[model samples]
Target: MLPALAAMVFTALLPNLDQWRRHELPVLPAAADGSVTFAGARVTLVELSPAQLTTYGDQPFELPHGVMAWRAVLRLESADPTLNDYCEIALEDAAGRVYETGADEISRARTDFATCKADASPAPGASPTASASPTASASPGAAPSPTSGPDAASGSRVYETVAYFATPVGTEAVAVRLHFPSDAYHDYRLTPQG
Candidate 1:
């Protein structure tokens, strides 16, 4: 009886091999200024910096005591529009702390977009340019509505995604992580910038 009970307990405590093979192992790392081709689409981390802007839109306010605004602009394009469905985007600092977009008052302020996606119809400056999160009416996790026209397929759709993070003044953002850990494409290959 004792041997049978130990076997049962050991089986229950065993690691989930199926999930590890599917989710935790696959990840693709990218450079701050380069593009990576995934199975679904082409993704580029255009520029990343601790932005030095006096304002986001036509508003102004103060940050907490010691914090700064960091920005990362990404470029995405694909043959299938469903590539726009990357559900998770976040920044990882050197110490491995993650700061998700829209986590702070400044990040949630009215800017260009709430999530990363391609605009089937490009409209520059169409979004409300407000600060202090007043006019952030852009739908979170939604792509702009595509225009109804047959000839619109002549060109590939390009999505320029801008994401922001508010962190402690001296924190250095190490990597821009995309998608969630539980996702199938979690496999990462870091390409160091020369």
Candidate 2:
């Protein structure tokens, strides 16, 4: 009875031990370009566009008072081939405030920026046009494409995505944080010029 009780207690405490171990891991710092590798995946922040007013599909978009929308263009590359849908991406402001990307915000960005499409292929010498509908190319019965990262056929694939954040006015010294499932995260600072 004593041995059985001990085993049960050990099992109950195992998860906590693993959590403690994960907490001890250091957070990796991303480069100025917002490029970092976590869990064998490479993530790059291609652009950060902060706008007060924008047009999406000929429709105007305006932020609420004391708020501004920031469009983040990111490129992700992974050699593991398997899609990691568990990543949590957020913007951390100088005041330690975090903002997440929502579905509505993503749709707005997608409409304004054609490159935000999951399978956007701009024709040669043809400019991108804004449309309310999602880009259609998937065949019936085909698996839905990965939303966060690019689709790759080989062991490695590179894809770009756009995330929108509504932050308060006067917010500066911002950084993008990419949190992985392993509890390890990376911070990439957004420069004023870039």
Candidate 3:
């Protein structure tokens, strides 16, 4: 009787691995219309256009608060068998200030996706707001009524990454960047530069 009882208790106490991972793991962003699929990976927001930025729940998804945590799954286009390539996730403020997160300079290793949660607030005039949550009007995966034509791919290596920006609840815009942890691709790698 004692052995049976202990076994039952242990089974109940053991954490569900999937649930545990889900809590810590980051999911992919919802597929957005007109965004091109690169290297068989979905580049959800190819680029944020001017009209999309003005409207909420539209093409341009709302930029996140500097403090909110975001996740993006990135993969090496061509994995090197002999050497482990390094990759990094970065964020840029409207003023051109760049904030870096993800794998350190020497390695492209991380627990899951490139995660960036703001530890400090954005500078004055560069903070994003709470009203900017992109999935506000409807559920995250709902289709947009107007489908814009797909944009041309920039031919750069694509990595899926989600990021959170922590700022005063009113930041309108931010630029995001991606780079090899080696800093091999310095220019033409940043996204959301407008």
Q: For every model shown, what is its TM-score relative to the native structure?
A: 0.58, 0.52, 0.30
lDDT of each: 0.53, 0.51, 0.31
Best first by TM-score, ranked: 1, 2, 3
As a TM-score, model 3 comes out at 0.30
* Best of the candidates, lDDT: 1
List, residue by residue over 1-194, the lDDT tens digit for candidate 1: 99999998878766445333434544566645455655455566656787653455555545667888777765555655444555456667788666767755565454344444443432434542211121222443233333323422344444446677788889988766676333565743322233
Ranking by lDDT: 1, 2, 3
lDDT per residue as tens, model 2, 118-194: 33333233334322122222211011233333333355545555556777777762666565655544333332234
- Clash count list over all predictions: 9, 0, 17
lDDT tens readout by residue for model 3, 43-131: 33334222212123233344334332233222222111113233344444566544444323212212223321111222234333222
Question: Of the candidates numbered 2 and 3, which has the greater TM-score value?
Answer: 2
